[model samples]
Each structure stands twice: as structure tokens, then as C-alpha cells.
Target: MKERKGLIIGSVIMIAIFVLMFIKGEPSKSIMVWIAAILTLSIYSFLYKDNVFYKFAEHLFVGVSVGYSVSVVWQNAFIRRVFDPLFITRTYIVNDKFSLYLFLGIVIPTLLGLLMLSIFTKKQAWLIRIPIAFVVGSYAGMGIAPSFQANIFEQTRSTLYVTLSISASIMIVGVISTLVYFFFSKEHKGLLGKTANLGIWFIMIAFGASFGYTVMARISLLIGRMQFLLHDWLGVIK
Candidate 1:
């Protein structure tokens, strides 16, 4: 009985909002605004309780996202990168003659991509490993040296301060104490133990600050949505 009452109330509210939108909103953009408003409210309905409206909105969101992603990848990556280069080249790289390297580049990757599709077949599923290994190994080789230099070497270099101001001194102490806290090889029972406990305090402060920042970001999103509903949809606020 409660569920039926809630459903009727929700339907009435939706219909009223749509009618107001049609009356007051721009004819060109009102339909799109109505759709977005409906979807937003459908998602928010989950806060009251689970219902068919929320489920429908969620499934529609996922389906649209997937369709858009596939269309983008096919247009930008496959057609532009692979198909155009292979068949539509007018310029030559080798002494005004056509370049074989361009053709080989497209053909090799295309063959490997096709081999990856072998996973669908029971007998030739092992062929998928060739493309997988090629992709993984290529990315790892390209990324490792740059990542090590940027993350490890540059960070360590930046921590070494020549002149110790108040801020630099605090940073130095925090870095040393944090390192000490991780040193499980030594029994933490002396001055080392005290430094490690200080490290724990620093870590907790950092975590709390991060959580506060995340909460503020979520609140900002909520504020933006509320502003849209008021100013754009209802025209109650400028």
C-alpha cells in the first residue's frame, strides 16, 4: 500500500514538472532539459529506496556510455589509424616510390588484432597470447624508465634541501620519520620508536586532509546540480 502511494505521488510530481517545463522553457531546448531532469531525478530516487525507475535510468546510462565509446573508438582509432593509412596514401617515402613500411605497419597490427579474436574459438584460443604479450611488453618497456626517473629519482632529489627554512625543516623531519616508521628490521623501542610514533601522527593528518578534500568535492557537485535545477529548470534563481 505504501509503495503504491509513493509511485502515484512520484508520477504526479514528474508530470507536473514536465508540464511546467513545456509552458515556461525554450521550445528548442526544453525537450532535452526534460530528459536530463527526469534522468537526474530517477537516479536520485534511489536515496529514498530502490525502485524500477532508478534501475531503468542506470541501465540506460550504461548502454549509452558503451555505445558512445564504441563509436568513438571505431571512428578515431580503427578507421583513421589503420584503414586510411593502408589504402589511401598518395605520398611516397622512398625516392618518390611507395613505402612498404607503411603497409607493413598496418598489416602487422591488423593481423595481431585478428589473432586476438581467436579467443572466441576453443581450438585456437592460445593465439590470443601473442597480441596480449606484445601489447603488455611494449607498454612496459616504454613506460618503465620514464616512470622510475619521474617518481623515484626526481622525488628523492627534490627532498634534499640545501638551505633549511622552517617549512623545509618540517618536510625533512616528516620524510625521515616516515622512513623510520617503515623500518621493521630494527626493534622500535628507543628514540626510533618515538620518531615512528610521530610518523603515525603525520600519516593520520594526511589521511584526514584527503578525506576532507573528497567530501568538499562531492558537496561542490551537489551544489552545481542544485543550481542547475533552480536556475535553469525552474527559473527560481538567477
Candidate 2:
């Protein structure tokens, strides 16, 4: 009964707003603008309670995002990298002569890709492992150096760079204490126990800051939608 009453109230408010816009000659002429307004409202309806409108908007957003991603990958990655080089332009032919280096580079990867489709066949299912292993091994090899450089080396360098500063001293202590807290080899006793307690305080402060940042980002998105509705759609604000 409460849900029904809330739904009716929401519907009346939406209709009243649209009617007012119509009266003021401020109704959006663009079909796309109307669609955007409706979808935005549908998503925002979840603030009151979950309903069919919110679900529809959620599903539509996900579906459109996935479809767009696939289309982009197909056009930009596969078509440009694989198809165009192999069959269309035949760029593997260096000068007027065939280049073994270019040929192997393209053909080998293409064969491995085709091997992935072998999973569809019962007898050839094991063949898929070959490409899978290759992909995993190559990606891990490629990712390791960059990830280590960024996450470890760069972070450590930045942390210790301004060692004289108060913030840097706190970060240095935080890093050391946090490392000690995770060192479970010996029982945390005496000084170790004290350090670990300090680590807990640092960890809680970091987590609280991260959570607050995330909340502010979400609130910013909400404010953006409100601005769009008030200024662009309703013409209530310039």
C-alpha cells in the first residue's frame, strides 16, 4: 500500500512537471533530449525505492555499454590489426618481396586465435589450451615489468622523495608500520605490538578517506543530473 502510494505520487509529480514545461513552451524539441530526460529520471527513481523504471534503465545502460564496447573492439582492434593487415592491404609484403618477419608475426597470432575456436569441437577441445596458455604467458610477461614499475618502484620513490616534509614522515611511518603489521612470522609482542596498533589507525584513516572520496564522486554525478534537469530540460535555471 505504501509502495503504491509512493508510485502514484511520483507519477503525478512527473506529469505535473511535464505539463508545466509544456505550458511554458519549454518542452524539449529533440527526441534524444526527451529520451535522455526519461532515462535519467528512471535511474533516479531508485533513490525512492527500486521499481520497474529503475530496473529498465539499469538493464538498458548495461546492454548499451556492452554493445558499444564490443563494437569498438571489433572495429578498432580486430579489423584494424588483424583483418586489414592480412587480406586487405597485404602489407606483410615488404617492398615487392615477402617479409618473413612480418608474415610470421601476423600469421602465428592469427593461427593461435583460430585455435581458440577449437573449443567448440569435442576432440579438439584440448587444442584451445595451447592458445590460452600462450595468451596468459605473454600477457603476464608484458604486464609484470610495467606493474612492478608503477606499483612498487614509483610509489616507493614518491613516498621517500620528500623525506624532510611532515606528510612524507607520516607516510614513511605508515608504510613501515603497515609492513610490520603484516609480518606474521613472529608473534606481535612489545614494540611490534605497539607498531601494529599504530598500523591499524593508519589503515582505518586510509579506508575512511577512500570511502569519502567515492561518496563525493557519486554525489557529483547526482549533481550533474540535477543541473541537466533544471537548466537544460526544465529551463528553471540558466
The CA lDDT of each predicted structure is 0.83, 0.89
lDDT of 1 by residue, 16-109 (tens): 9766865775433477766877788788889778999999999999999999999999989888877777666532245767678766777899
TM-score of 2: 0.84
For model 2, residues 1-238, the per-residue Cα lDDT tens digits are 9989998998899879767865775655778877898999899889778999999999999999999999998899779889999899988997799998998888898899889999999999999999999999999999999999999999988887875988888999999999888999989999999998899899999999999999999999999997877667766666
**Angstrom error at residue 133, model 2:** 1.8
> Model 2 — which ten-residue stretch has the worst lDDT?
21-30
Q: Model 1, residue 15: displacement in angstroms?
A: 13
What would the TM-scores of all predictions be?
Answer: 0.81, 0.84
- Candidate 1 — number of clashing residue pairs? 0
